[model samples]
Target: MKIVIAEKPSVGRELAKVFGATTRKDGYIEGKGYSFTWAFGHLLQLAPPQDYGFIGWRKQHLPMLPQKFKLAVRKIKTKDGFVEDPAVRKQLDTIKKLFDEATEIIVATDAGREGELIFRYIYYYLKCKKPFKRLWISSQTDEAIKDGFRNLKPGTDYDTLFNSAHCRSESDWLVGMNATQALSISAGNRTVLSLGRVQTPTLAMICARFLEIKNFVPQTYYQISILLSKDEQVFKAISTANYKEKEEAEKLFVLVEDVASGFPAGGNITAVEAKPRKEPPPLLHDLSSLQQEANKKKGYTADQTLSILQNLYESKLVSYPRTGSRYIGDDIFAGVPDLIAKFTGHPDFGKQAQFLQTVALNKRSVNAKKVTDHHAILPTGEQAYGLSADKQAVYDMVVGRMIEAFHQECLKELTKITIQSGVTFVANGTVIRSAGWRAVFNDPEDDKKDEDNAALPKIAVGEQLPITEKSLLEKQTKPKPMYNEASLLKALETCGKEIEDEELRYAMKDSGLGTPATRASIIETLITREYITREKRNLVPTNKGLAVYEVVKDKKIAQAELTGQWEKRLEEIRSGSSVKDFKSEITEYTKTITHELLIAGASISGKLEEEKKAEKVEQ
Candidate 1:
């Protein structure tokens, strides 16, 4: 019998039902030629220092590099001490028994990086040598499962992927474990001040932004605005340049008012530029994009958004939640209309689904070369009725974007009007030519914009009109807004380079700070370590967090670019690059960073260290 191991019992049960594995047992289900079992995420992990005979924290054991990293069953911290979880152990035993008896194994874990780690760790930990095949599927739909079985790949085909995942785990263990120990020890050892390959740079982003905000000095400025009227329509335009003083602005404001009052034909409309603009529908969402959108629109935190999306995916209501690709391949695109059809009569999205049927599919989001791991998140065409309010919100976003992607462009007429009245006061307006795909969702006008989107009256070059009103407006230069979840995710997605265009940002995502699956956890780790706090929608660094940042700000770990480079290396490793070379680089860097962090921790928290020594001396 073939042993089919799934990532979770729920998924296992579904697969079991599909394969006729109806006989339920202690930790798995059994049927004809297949024994389906499940693992509760990761069953094993890299053993901690004490497990390797490094009994306690001491300076001499600073960089505890292991020659052969050992895998032990995952331990949970209890009141007595760290103990193996009984549930996890029982499941592992059942899996071991099934594997021992099986002629072959079928790996039915989540089809992603972390999922690979989960199964590989179990296989290696249990020391199973059976020939195995990987059953990779994007969704829990029965049809998808059937297709995956018919196309199972050699488990060896994913050996490169497993090596990549293993390297990531070991690299994190080496860097995070050593650096965290070194820094925590030097900083008076008061608390477990934590750091990680991804979390530290993330902390640095928050602290840097916070410091920028804390030190910003606002400057006052003034602008001259004149309200002009032509053909019974009035609109406002501001001075081309902001004046340093109100007196200068006032002087300009007077001249503009006089010039406008004298002119009959709209104050010499030197230039009236009108051009049609089309906004192609937004591409499907990757996890980060989804989280950013949810944060911006629904005020959900990054962690909250991931949790919701994950729940939706596990419920088989959506595709893989941890996808990084925002584009689907031609194969997936061929069936999109059919998937959208599932939402027909969906109560909320029924009309949208029906409308999308008539519109030609926008091939903008279809690119086979761009898709990796899994395609962008999409509804599984499963019933989405009865989702809680939050889940429904995310589900709606996925369904809406899919429908929108198949529609026409959102065309608008952009008009720029420049009036020369000793100074060029410019006015701009956008008139929607056709809502198109935007109509699939809510009104696009709901988004706030700095420019006045009021209708611009028809005017031509050389035409002049009298000014209706003129005034000097007082304004202050505003500092960069605090890093809200959305903006911060955007920053992280682009490695601190602020890019507004979706395609460019998506291109930069692979080289960003962390993987889509791990970024949410990184943010939460910062909060858990008390390194950052959520101030409303903003991620603010706590005092302890700031101090940690101060110590390591000059270090390599605090730089986002460093993390980006590491991300690139991980990708290289995933694509058949040598894991040994990557591990070697991480080991050397670990030594340097461990030393740097030790010195930094001592220098920054020297007073605390002295106090700690004094207390010890007294004792």
Candidate 2:
């Protein structure tokens, strides 16, 4: 008999069904030759400082770098102290019993970094030596499940992935634990000052944005607008030059109105340039893209988006929700037609699906090398009618993207017409020659991105139109908008670089501050630590958050480059690069950072002393 373990009960039951384990038993199901059990996510975690007898946090015991890291059962904080969760302990006992009785074990957790860590930790905790095989699948579809079983990989195949995950966890512990204690002691306050490798840089982005907006002084500028009409079609155009003073623009505005009063054959059109443009359908939605879209369209937070996507995945209506790749491998591409066929006449997407079936698939989204552990988030070919409104919305978004991915590019004509009035004023517009994928949404009103997307009436070179109205328009140079979850996600995706080289940037995107699966929680951690707060859709730094930023602003921890380099090295570790190089670097940096923070505390104290003397002298 073999034992199977999964990340959660919801997943365990799916694996159980595939293995013919029909007998429902205590804390697990068993039948035939298999026993399927689950962990409640993480049953084991790193031992805390107190676990090693370093109970109280003394300044002398600041940097606690253990020679051998220890593991303990996951515990929860109670009124008195931390204790093991009974449910977790009980489940572990059941799994241990199965391992003792089984001929071999099967590890069937989610195929990702954290999932790898979860299973490995449980094996070590239970002290099991049973040979195990790994079941790796991205979707819960019956076909995907059966296929994964037929192709079980060796448990050792992913050892490097485990190494990478383990390194990430331990490094966070070493730096975060030591720096947090050092800073707290230096501040000389009971308030626990939290610091993280990723979260600190993320917080710095928000605080810096807030400072920029807070200190901005708006500058007024002036321009001229001319309302021109040709063949009963009217459109607005702006001046080619800007006037620093309103009076200067007013004079030009008056002259333009005088010309319009006479309706002089529309200030002779000097040039008309028209070019065809194409907007290819957007790529498939990875987790970050879905979260950004949800934040922009439905005002959902990153955590809310992940939760909804996770629910959809568990319900078997969608694939995995935590994927980072937006492209699918050829293996998965062969099955896309079947998934799309399920929606043929899907009351909501039926018409679009029917049309997509006839279009040639653009292989830009079918590169196997671009796919990582999982493909892009996609539908499971399962019925999706019973979901709640929020779930339905997310499901529709995923399904709609699939429909768009296979359709033809939208065709449009971009026209730039220059009118000669001593100074050239230009009018720009785009006319959709063919809707293509845009037909999927069937909402022309919503398709318009700006005035640029509006249709332009037909006109040729040297063509003249009547100027019906003209005036001066006053506008202020606006500051950059506040940081919202959508924009922040984009910034994080690019590793906070204002990069235009797509290939270079895409290569470095993996070096972002946090993993897609963990970025939401990192943000929530900052909020829980009172470093930042949400004001409607915008993220605003609190006073305490700003002070923390100030102390670490000049330090390495608050810099994205430092965090990004660590992230890059972690990826190298995933590909079998040595862990010793990274480990050595982080340990040395930790000591230097601890010392700097202590000195920062002293510097702050000196500044306070000077302020006190200034106050006394004034008095």
Candidate 3:
């Protein structure tokens, strides 16, 4: 008999149904040469510091670096202390029994790094030696599942992926456990000050920005806008003025509009340039991008979107929810037509579905070279039914994104007209010739430009156009905004550079501060530790968070780029381009950071104590 183990019971049941494993048991399903079992997310995890014989919070254990981390059954919080999770242990026992009886094992966990770690930790903890094959399917469609079984790869082929995943888990544990304990102890705070590979830098970003904003003194700047009119056509032109005083801006506005009739003209409508631009449809939804769009449109937090997407994935309405790539693989391209056809009768797709049938779908998003462990998140083509309102919203996003990915590019004409007053003025406008793929998701708000750009209208070069109104606009130089969940995720993806280079961003994408699968959880960790709180959508640092940030602000420990570099090295290790020098480097870095933290000048707890004493004296 062959035993298959999945990450969760929901996934296990789905696979079991397709495989005809109908006989249900306590912890597994059995029928016809197959036994399907499931784990409750994680059956085993790395043992904590105390489990390694390191007693209570002490200075000697400041930088507790384990030579070889130990794995044990998952633990749960009891009234007295953490105890072994009974449900996990029982399921493990059942899995072990099945492993003992079966000739071979199949790992059917989620198709990503964390998923890989989850199963490997269990197999190692249980000391199971049976040879195993990997079931690597993205969506759990019956056809996809059947195809996966026929082409099962040897388990050893994924050793590099497992290595990367293991390294991630261990590194996060080392940094988070050591840094958190060291900071908490040094500060003498009774409350636990938590930090992690992703959360620490993220918290630092919010606090740093908050400080900058708080300390900033707003300065007024002025610019002049000219209203031009000719032949009943009206257009507005802006004066490029950098005036420290309002009087100077008024003088320039007067000179341009009144003193010299429309100012001395250097040129007027020298050329009218209009070119057709095609904006290809957006690729399918990846988890981060989906979270961002949802946050922007529906005001759902990143964590909320992740939860909703997870539910959608479990319900078999979408593909895997934690993918980084927005591209599908070549193998999955053949399934696209049928999938698109499933939406034909839906109100959202009734008109657009016919367009898909007539035009050849773009295959730019389907590249095997770009696909990692999992393809993009897409609808499973199953009829979505009986979904909660939140789930329905997310489902629509996925379906709409999928339909858009295959549709034709959006065509638009960009017109740039330059006008002359005393100073040169510019205006820009875009005429949409065809909405094309944008028709799939009818979002009118998407047409709005970024805040930096001013709206303009269509006018030919040298064509006399009337300005509707002229005014001197006063604006203040704005400080950076606080990191909302969406913006923070974008910052992480770019390693905090705010880069505009596509290739650089792409190179840095995989090395992002946190894996796509774990970023939402990292934000939650910050909130749980009281390091940060949400004021509406913006993440604001708490006192503890700010204190920690102040201490680490100048250190590599608080820089997202440093972590990105480390991630690059780990990737090199996976590809055999670099030796695994990570352990030694991590050991040395942990020691340095912990020592510095212990002796750092800031005394947050002492300050608190002094404040309390002063308050008592006043009373």
Candidate 2 structure lDDT:
0.82
TM-score per model over all chains: 0.95, 0.94, 0.92
Best by lDDT: 1
What local lDDT does model 1 show for residue 24? 90
Q: Order the candidates by lDDT, highest first.
A: 1, 2, 3
Candidate 2 residue-pair clash tally: 1
Supply the TM-score for candidate 3. Answer: 0.92
Off by over 4 Å in 1: 258-266, 445-448, 606-619
lDDT of 3 at 313: 78
Tens digit per residue, CA lDDT, model 3, 379-495: 988878899889998888888888888998888777766666556666666667888888887745365543213334445556544345667789888888878888888888877
> Of 1 and 2, which scores higher on TM-score?
1
Indicate the residue-level lDDT of 310 in model 2: 91
Poorly placed runs, candidate 2 (over 4 Å): 257-263, 443-453, 499-505, 602-619
> Mind giving the per-residue lDDT tens digits that candidate 1 earns over 1-619?
8899999988899899998879999999999888899999989999998878877877789788999999888888999998998889988999999999999899999898888999999998889888899998887778889999999999999988888888889999998998898898887777677888889988998899889989999999988777888788878887789889888777777667443466454366788899998888888888988998899889998889888988887777888889989999999988998988888887666887888788777888999999988999888888766889999998888888788877788888888898888678888888888888888865666443564656798787887788777777888888798998888888988789988888898888778999888888888889888888888888998767877888989998888988888888888888999888988899998999889988888754754455557768989
- Show the lowest summed lDDT stretch of 10 residues, model 1: 257-266
- Give the clash total for candidate 1: 7
Local distance difference test, each candidate = 0.85, 0.82, 0.78
